[model samples]
Target: MDRPALLAALRARVGRLERAGAAAALARSQAGVVHLSEDIDAHLPQGGLARAGLHEVLAAEPGAAAGFAAVILGRTGGPVLWIGPDPDAWPSGLVRYGLSPAELVLVRAPRPADGLWAMEEALRCAAVGGALLALSDIDLTAARRLQLAAEAGGALGLLLRPDTEEAGPSAALTRWRVDALAGSGGSAHSLGDPRWQLDLLRGRGSTPRSWTVAWRTTTDRLETEGGTLAAPTRNRRRA
Candidate 1:
């Protein structure tokens, strides 16, 4: 083989080896960490939510996505800093979801830039257990900043983006798309547990997967079995 061709081949081989080494290292690191619940933990590469990482949550239905995030925040036992415009959470409603209104500090930013700033600052606060932000648009640079801040404080950062926004490149540790199911509610008069079709679109050192989960807000419990809708039966007219 020519000298130049031999050198190029060697470089390509080195590059491939480097990529494989990085993937293996990431997998080893993730296997030791487990966050959230058993169902989600089993699917995630990191086992559970990484305490010092950023997680992105998006859904076509805004309410469904918000509920999913709420469940995560509920698992944290410290104060939660929520930043956004016109948060949809009701003080009483949060109780059913395992969040205490007293433990929440809400910050309403007049603009998107201000909101992002608040989120980064909140995530950096050691006293804060988690930071939640509602954003319609975000770039790679901004997302990385949030991730770093969360790592510094060992807090979980949840970014809620609009479904209309495309799932482009992000520095977030995990990206999830939550869709609310029709059977989320119970009877005509009373609302029962909320259910969702949770899609894990992206994760570090993990494959994408989906699940149907039921959340009993009153008890803050997640049930994975017997929540799915039954197949519809086709009726045929008698001849």
Candidate 2:
């Protein structure tokens, strides 16, 4: 096999082994998974973001990452818990993304350790439909703890970390990076709908992929702007 193909195969094998334990657990929780767009779900092992699994979202742009994550939680039928150092997410901003403020539970943890603790507790709470932790960094151990917590609680755990953090190995079912994209001109009176380039850096039994999409308020859905690709350029973040 070619050098690139060989390396890719080896990497995929390693990822599978690293996540082997959680695979069976997540498989059993497929009924609790929340489906995204059919196209995006097609590439995910659980057919969508498994509600009882942990996922990572790189904070390439804080707003873009939060917006994307919010879009995911909007699909859920229950409350969301957000734990982080910042408590600046006001209701008005999230409403447009289809996430209601009333459904959110915000907890501010000034210290990193405190934030992790809060996230772990929230993830393991069955009452929480989703838990989002905004962190600057995380290790494989911490990621695994949160992953297992999500499994136990039947809630989705989302880690929003800075893009500068090395995209190392993790226990997350999927890692994503969302970057704000230039708006496509349409409404002269508006700045155009929010657009983002989404990179699925890695997934369980799924090849890395990229999609450009816009959150259309009128349609209340994330529409793929130019469709999707099996793999984006190497310049983009990958794990």
Candidate 3:
């Protein structure tokens, strides 16, 4: 099949699956494992965020966002399959966040569509403890399908996209906007500093907030102050 046709088919299948009762059952069965960071709790107001099921983290850029998401999944301490077309150059810093490079299964695809397909197949595999699928671009329909698949598999699905694309409504259970922050180390802090500023754009059963978090590179820890940035009371609806 042609690329467009194949993607359309995948989207249709994923949509049907997401609406099926099995998806909700899968999410419920997989709901107990989410462990939110102290900083995340402060911003969330709800003590902690949901861990199981599919959540979306939207970012203005791919680097910081993908790294931040990696840090979250790294804590699961399970085999992770990182799927992308450019797997050879997968970020090395993921190791610093507690993910053992040896435990990662890298799947390389030739195109964005192929990468999506590979991600679906990998997440469907029960042997995989968790999976992180990085995409350069995706539409609303495709994103919804991925969210469903992650829900069914009980895995964390992180979608990394440009800031321009994230300015809209999505089917993800939670949405996060992350940006770089000043490193905690002295003025000499360089590329690997374990600190970040994350904004919780949207979440279920909670308000939107922002956090100045210290993301430890060595221990894969996320810490933040005891306050949160209140979400705007009124704003334009995302597309």
TM-score of 2: 0.83
Tell me the whole-model lDDT of each prediction, alpha carbons only.
Answer: 0.70, 0.77, 0.61
Leading candidate by lDDT = 2
Ranking of all predicted structures according to TM-score, beginning with the best and ending with the worst? 2, 1, 3
Model 3 — which ten-residue stretch has the worst lDDT?
A: 230-239
RMSD of each: 15.3, 12.5, 7.0
Candidate 2 local lDDT, 117-187, one digit each (tens): 77786666555567789887888898898898987877788998888746788899988988988766656
**Could you tell me the C-alpha RMSD of candidate 1 in Å?**
15.3
In candidate 3 the C-alpha lDDT for residue 23 amounts to: 41
> lDDT at 213 for candidate 1?
81
Q: Which digits, one per residue and each the tens of the lDDT, describe model 3 over residues 67-139? A: 7777766655455667666664254667766667765766666688787776765455433446666665677
* True-structure Cα RMSD, model 3: 7.0
Cα deviation at 230, candidate 3, in Å, is 1.6
Give candidate 3 regions above 4 Å deviation: 1-31, 42-52, 88-91, 189-192, 232-239
- Supply candidate 3's per-residue lDDT for 229: 56
